[model samples]
Target: MATFLHRLGRGAFRRRRLTLLLWAVVLGIAGAAAAGSGSGSGDSNVTLPGIEAQKAYDVLDEKFPAANADGASARVVVRAPDGKKLADSGPRAEVRSLLADLKDSSPRVAAVADPFVARTISADGTTGYAQVTYKAKATDLTDADHNRLDDALDDARGHGLTVEASGSALAPAAEAASSEAIGFLLAALILVVTFGSFIAAGLPLLTAVVGVGLTMGAITALTAALDLNSSTSALATMLGIAVGIDYALFIVSRYRSERAAGHEASEAAARANGTAGSAVVFAGLTVVIALVGLAVVNLPILTAMGLAGAGAVVVAVLVAITLVPALLGFAPERVLGRASRKKSGQESRPKTTASKLPAAERWAAFVLRRPWQVLLFSVLGLGVIALPATKLELGLPDDSSKPTSTTERKAYDMLAESFGPGFNGPLMLVVSGGDPAATKTAVAQLDRGVKDLTDVAAVTPATYNPAGDTAMVTVVPKSSPSSEQTKDLVHSIRDRAQGVETATGAQALVSGTTAMNIDVAAKFSAAIVPYLALVVGLAFLVLILVFRSILVPLKAALGFLLSVLASLGVVVAVFQWGWFQDLFGLQTTGPVMSLMPILMVGIVFGLAMDYQVFLVTRIREAYVHGADSRTAITEGFRHSGKVVMAAALIMTGVFGGFIGGADAMIKSLGLGLAAAVIFDAFVVRMTIVPAVLALLGQRAWSLPGWIDRRLPHVDIEGEKLGAIPAPSEPGHRDADFTPTH
Candidate 1:
């Protein structure tokens, strides 16, 4: 691995112009393809096939075409001004006119139902709602369509009525831009501090941005042929930029270290690519493996997300190994800090005594001195933070979870206040069977049974299709959509469905936005254990290959799990339990987003293992080169500690920037990922790992003889590079070299 990478890096450096041109060409091709293909829509359907909600949806799609299963819908909630009633002649005329105008608002407007005709007026006649249906899905709606809808809404508000629009078709309130800009700025600052040169600092940022553009362009281009989710682009951007910067940071930092150690520009670039680049590749592969493992859950949206994110990481790895070395070939001496440049091109020796060692080495020495206490306290602290995870409840976010400033949220509040929280989440009961009469009887029975059930707010009479082969009934729960009681009610109705079927000889299934979201949450929940097992198992194998040891991989995986759970606990505390909501700019809190746990596990696991591989690989490298375990720990920290800290801080800053987003899911994701990086990078990898390994001594690197014999060697530490004599050394050969190991 080291020998090949050395040659590759040297080739790229010597032919720097060619390498840079290749990357530019790739980016240009991707951008052109995306431009020609244009933008695409996302697939928000996450319902599992076997679930009741999905089954109900299938029935509706087959038997009742009028349900408009694929179309978008909206509710325009209108309230009369103070001292006014919607039923009054004057207000009623305005409301009727508003509904009439909605029909001609846009060509995409499929249908509009009046409040009076649909009997949607509030019992007090103070508030009413009109239903607007669009011919296309929400993602397919154009800016013109939105403008027309807005014009219609504005006209209604022009009267004395208080009008707000909610639902899927309202073109979800414009989201605040993601944390990319903030991430870039923070990464630039951190890189500048780490490298102490504006030019050098910009290399990582430059490579990262290029990698992101390439990945995003490819995603956009492919969207023309695929049903990729819109969120996939955002996620890919986040991971691509982050790993791109960090990967480049590793190689650049190592190159400078080599330059400071008296290696010439070309040799330093090759050596950096051979050693740090190997770690970057392994780190990147771990992330890719963890993300692509999302396919195990068998959901298309998640699969696309994982694949897209993994593709970004792969691009980052390629850019780091090639572009970075090529760029370094330009002016390697300029990358050196002023103090490093003053050393006049001589090899530097390591400081022997603790007092003379760098701060990282001194910290390692201090931890080794009291390994037991450090391990105990670090483990206990993480365990305490993980306690909140026990009470975690999962649900998808709704308008109620949006910021109060959004019209959707205001509309939701108005409807919930006037009608009841249940009005926000009506469950649709679909009854169908061989006999039309039997299906009608089943629908009637369901309505009566559901009404008698506790927590039932109201059950609408059954509406039958023209064939009378299918019937639909709407049941409203007393609780909000995300509430535990609503989920329980959904389950209760499904349980009672069997009796209704047995009596009337018809099939009854439950579905609606609320029930469908519940099913989605349940599906994600069930996938957690399997997804975790897959990521951890694959990561464990990858680590074994990288480190050639069992205990180290075990320790790395366990530490990652600890950090991930602790991060999730914090997410639940903040997003679900409503603790310190104001601190995160949250207007309200309920159940945490259903997929956040699995998402956190996949993403955080990859990043955690990344830190683990980078940190531990250095220790193993020192040990393999004949340093004692204790000395190796100190040496590894002395060489790699500062870079690791800088990488983690950049990753944290990038992720933390998302917490400021208006979207609840994005905010939760940002916070969860940021917190995980902090815990794993600072606490687990840095503190607990060192303490635990210090106690284990040489045994920490032990592997069974049989396993070692069968395992394929992966020289991730670039140990073979030792055979390649430095330019300053005697008997050095420029052309041909053989790897010793």
Candidate 2:
């Protein structure tokens, strides 16, 4: 495997330019083709299977034969110019004209509902609404469709009228479009800075662009294959830009370092391929493992996330080797050349004083220069940033009223004004009982409790099949599903109804939107720790065997934990505190997504491993070559610091790009990740890690001599797992021990 990797790397070094151009071209063509194909994407149906939902869909189909067939079940509510005029005559006229236009021009609109003319209203008929419903030819409404609907409504409004648009289709589409562009730009900048040379800088971008392009092409072509999830574009945007760029960065950095060490470009490429390139494979694998795990959720949207996320990672890893190497091969040593001119007859010059200086000389000087001040300041700085996390609230919300436009905003207002403040769906709690009388009595009591609560606006009489073990209660709150009130009701209902059915020996389980989120948090308690232990322990075990170090693994894990904690703190402050809207330009009020933290940890941890390997591997190499602990640590930092910082900056920028986008979910993700990277790079990698390692001194790599001798070295990544030695009485030490301060 090592030999094969080396040969492949060398081949890329030999043929870099042609390879890069080909990948770029392939990526571009595929991207353009996909954009063209995805034009009607927002028009698809959600494909949910339920009688009421289906009935609702059928009603829409029956009413608005003018709507899109292949599109989503789209709806538009026409009010008045002031965003408050909700009456039938004004709304009905507008709905008729809109339906007329739909039927005449693009006849795909499956159905449109005239709720204004037909609805049963209050005794005073002054307040009325016209609802126009249409199905997307595809699945959900894209940003383009939303814009069109908004424009049409704007054009149609002649007098005192208001229009509001709502539904699943419109919101996500608009959110995706804005974010995708910002993410792309940020990722590109990061890639360029990491590889100073244009050729090298372009390698990752090239690979990403191509991989994403092809995947998009496949997504477009496969729209015919099955129902592609509505989040396809956003998914490709994330994976293609993030994992794609990341994979290339790892391989490119390795290749350049190898070439600088004096091997022929091809040979340097080969070694890098065997090492960093192989690591990329593992990194991508872990992400795929975690993302694919999302398949257990049973919701198609999550299934979409799994498919797209895993697919993108796979493509990124593959192209990082095949396409990236080919691109790098074009210029060989020049592909990742340092940012300096080759003077008249000089060799490529070093750009920075740090690069020119010997690693040993620099490490010794820094510690001697700043040991006391550095120790005092670094901890204090990280401590301040971590403060806000203490106030975090992990409860999920039920507000699905994301602002799509003036129409959506108005629609949200109308719903609140006319109907009441609450989500589309409320807490669906089920309490089981024995007989019809008992069940009725239990439901009556529960209804009274639900209605009396300050949070609940209304409670429907229980939907009970008395002979069965379940009685369903739908409790409507006075706020959106994501509001604090809804969360409060979730707690109240669960606590109040836990043992409501003693006669049936049955219990009540609250299982609506609010309950799902609360349960998710509960699940995280048991799940996150074990998952962390598994992955973190796995990473440590691998590092231990690879480097023959006990203290090193402990130190790495320690640093990883501190940085991760800090990231968590930021997540709590921004998401739990609802600070994203004011600070980061995200207008969101959703809870921390149930799966986000676990998935984030997996991705962040894997990426952190990249820096750990690159920086630490260099330090170990210096030690193997006979530098003392302080000297090796300094030298390693000096040598690998630039690439690490560059990588972090680029990644951070990419994550930060989503701060101003429309989607709260995307912004939250980007902000959390970006903050984590910045924290990891500056505080953890540069300061905290160095200090800990310095403090540990020679003990960082210590392992018992007996254990080292008895256990044949196991390298899970180096293809060295075949090495086996008989177990002996386990006692071995790899280095002389020194206790940490």
On TM-score, the candidate that comes out on top is 1
**Candidate 1 lDDT trough over 10 residues, lowest sum:** 732-741
- All candidates' TM-scores? 0.96, 0.75
Residue-wise lDDT of candidate 1 within 1-741, one digit each (tens)?
777888889988878889999999999999999899855566665656677788898888889978736788888999998888998988898898888878888788888988888989888889999999988888788888888888888998898788999877776556566579999999999999888888689999999989999999999988758878777887898899889999999899989888877777789899999989999988998999899998877767778888999999999999999999998877676777666677646557544575777777788888999999999999999999999999988777788888788889899999999999989999999999787889878887788789888889999888888899898999989998877798899999998899998887899988998998888878888889988888889889989889998999999988998998899899989988888989888888888887677877899989998899889988998999999998889889988998899999999999988888766777899999999999999999989999989989999999999999999887888878878988668986453323111
What is candidate 2's lDDT per residue for 1-741, written digit by digit as tens? 445565566566555656666766776776676666634443223332222223223433443233214344444555444433345556556656765653332233555555545662323343344444444432434456655655665666654445455654454434444655676677666666556676777777767777877777767755545556545555556656777777788778877665565544455566677666766665566556556655444345555656777788888887887776666555555674554323322343345585566543455356546766676676676677778766545543333435434455666666566656673446665655544566566676667666778888767666655254346677777776656677777777766665455533444556654556555555544466767777777777666666688887777777666666678778777776665456654454545655556556655675576567656766776776689988888767766676667777777766777665554455566777787788777776677667777777888878899768865553323343113111121442112212111
Judged by lDDT, which candidate is best? Answer: 1
User: lDDT scores for all predictions?
Assistant: 0.87, 0.60
lDDT, residue 392, candidate 1: 85
lDDT of 2 at 212: 77
